[model samples]
Each structure stands twice: as C-alpha cells, then as structure tokens.
Target: MSVDLSGAHWFKSTRSAAGNDCVEIAHLDGGRVGVRDSKNPHGGALVFTPLEWDAFLSVARGGEFDRP
Candidate 1:
C-alpha cells in the first residue's frame, strides 16, 4: 500500500530529549502510520498499517524492546 506522506505532520515522543537520535511519527490516511528519523526527515519512512501499529505498540508497552 502506497501512502502519500507529503502532507504528513511528524511528531516525536515527549520523552525524547534535545538530541538528534529520535523517531518521528505521522498519522496517514486509511488508518496507517509513518515512522522516520527526526534527523533525516527527507529520508524514507516505515509505513505501518493500523493492525501492525497496534501490535507494535502493545509489545512496546510491555517493554519488549526495552534495553535492560
């Protein structure tokens, strides 16, 4: 699925500090979402469907990707 992200309004997590190492997220059409590096806005992004995003969030909330 191709999502036109030309009008995407990307935002980063509030927990992110004043560093270039951050990811930006944007809500796309058809309940999709876009993720990209904040320091590289012009770069490509990883688009996720609603279901995929939800699953990822669930795992994230469970600390699956936490660095211990």
Candidate 2:
C-alpha cells in the first residue's frame, strides 16, 4: 500500500477550472493509480489497484458521486 510518489507525474482533470483547489492523479507502476491533494503534494497519496480504480472511474463517470 506504500507506493513511492517521489517521481510521480501528477496532473488534474482537464475539465477542472484554473484554480488551486483540486486533486491530482498519477498513473503508477503495475496499473495502480495514485491520488493526492494538489494543495499538499508532500502529504501523501491514496493508491488504488487497477480493478478498484477502474470501478471508481465507472461510478464517477456514471454520476454516482454527483451531489443530489
């Protein structure tokens, strides 16, 4: 679960507006993904397995996380 993010090439969604508040993501080795707060790059990251990341993207694209 401890993925080294030192060389991570973090980037935010292109759909995101030009602002400071956002989350950054990096595609890691072995198909894993890394996510971290843009405001705190050195804080830490949440690593997700390929399957888990894919499932999350599916729900996200389906608006499952949309506010009611």
Top candidate by TM-score: 2
Off by over 4 Å in 1: none
Which candidate has the top score in lDDT? Answer: 1
Q: Put down candidate 2 lDDT per residue, 1-68, tens digits, no spaces.
A: 67778888999999887985899999999999999998888897999999999999999999999999
Off by over 4 Å in 2: none
Error of 1 at 49 (Å): 0.2
RMSD in angstroms, all models?
1.1, 0.9
TM-score of each: 0.91, 0.91
Error (Å) of candidate 2 at residue 16 is 1.7
| Global CA lDDT computed for model 1 | 0.94
lDDT of each: 0.94, 0.92
Clashing pairs in 1: none
